[model samples]
Target: MSTPARRTGRPRSAEADRAILGATRAALVELGWGKLTMGDVAARAGVAKTTLYRRWAGKNELVVDAVAAVFDEHLEAADHGSLRADIEDVVVRFATLLERPETKTALMAVVSEATHDEALGARVRSAIVDRQKRLVLVGRERAQLRGELPPEEDPAAAARNADLIFDVIAGSVVHRLLVSAEPVDREWARSFATVLLHGLAAASSGTGTAPAPEPAREHRQKPAGSV
Candidate 1:
């Protein structure tokens, strides 16, 4: 008897990855979350259905990764002089990415599902939110170097601040564009940055000082543990 040929998946290919993700996004915009399927994506991408199955277990996982690829581009920011300028540049780019048909539709679908599915929610946080938060870290470091924001002495506080900053920026933008269905124009980005870095009063009247990180207080070492 002749030995049977072993079935094997196609070797991983960057070209294939690009084709699949691109086709998935395009299909998402056309067929939407409810209608899109792995078979259809493989057909559109011109690859074997097994290829998509090997790469992604299901449509939800694939869709999250596809939309994440769009949101994740904010990681590559160009130097825009002041911290405020950087903030404005990124905000506008972020808003534009959200406005893409596939990004909006896929992201909304996944997020709505994520609310009830813990695993999906965790995937969204790890693959998308956590990765993009590096933007907050980078911007904060630059601001510190330029004396725009005060240096944070407490390591724990620094982490908390970065999380809070990202939450505020991401939350406000998502609400304005997706929830309220308002335009996030350049003017809005500029104004939001001003309010974020400075306070509401400063953004409006230009009088209050920008809130900087509080300086760490000095302790006298507790006089060698004398309580």
Candidate 2:
């Protein structure tokens, strides 16, 4: 008789991962971070508690994974013909994600706790913030290829610039959503994009000031005799 093939244990399910993460987000929205538990997520996901524990150590890791998935779910690499358009598109998408009740609550609660938890803080940086910053680098590289942005002569400066831009865009949106309690709608994103793009264009061209407002046109009767 031929030897029987060896069999491995059951494979993990992608559907389970999605369900667990989705349930985690729902739990965060309904229970907040402090009250959320693996049991609750397991019940919500229709899986056993051991299933969740097998995938993540505890609430922090699971929440971070869930939140990161939310961010990744809607993110798209925009190629909107111009950097300004691309930035605006990304801004709108990010704003949409922040507007969701689950995302807003989970992000703030985790960030607040992470301030005192170094490991959690590092996880937040790696899982979510760093991925968000990648969008900026993508837009910048695309703009450079399209001749909209000049190639950087100094790699360090380029990196710093990218970091700064990421902070501005992400920070502003968060502030609007959480601190200011305002909507980051399309109009607001467009306005923000205009200001950001103009500033960038000015910096790239080494023009610090706003062209002196065209010297007010100097329309002093247009020299009545000199027409």
After superposing candidate 2, which stretches have Cα over 4 Å from the reference? Answer: 1-8, 200-227
Over 148-186, each residue of candidate 2 has an lDDT whose tens digit, in order, gives 666777999998998899999999999998899998877
Model 1, 1-227: lDDT tens per residue?
A: 99999878556898888789889999988997789999999999999898888888898889888878877654456557668888888888888888988788888998998999898899999999888988889887766665566778899999999999999998999999999999999888878887887778777685433554443334212223356
Q: Give the residue spans of candidate 1 off by over 4 A.
A: 1-10, 206-227
72, model 1: CA deviation in Å?
Answer: 2.7
Residue pairs with colliding backbones in model 1 are none
Best by lDDT: 2
Q: Give the 10-residue window scoring lowest on summed lDDT in candidate 1.
A: 215-224
Question: Candidate 2 at residue 24, lDDT?
Answer: 93
Model 2: ten consecutive residues of lowest lDDT: 212-221
Relative to the true structure, candidate 1 has a C-alpha RMSD (angstroms) of 7.6
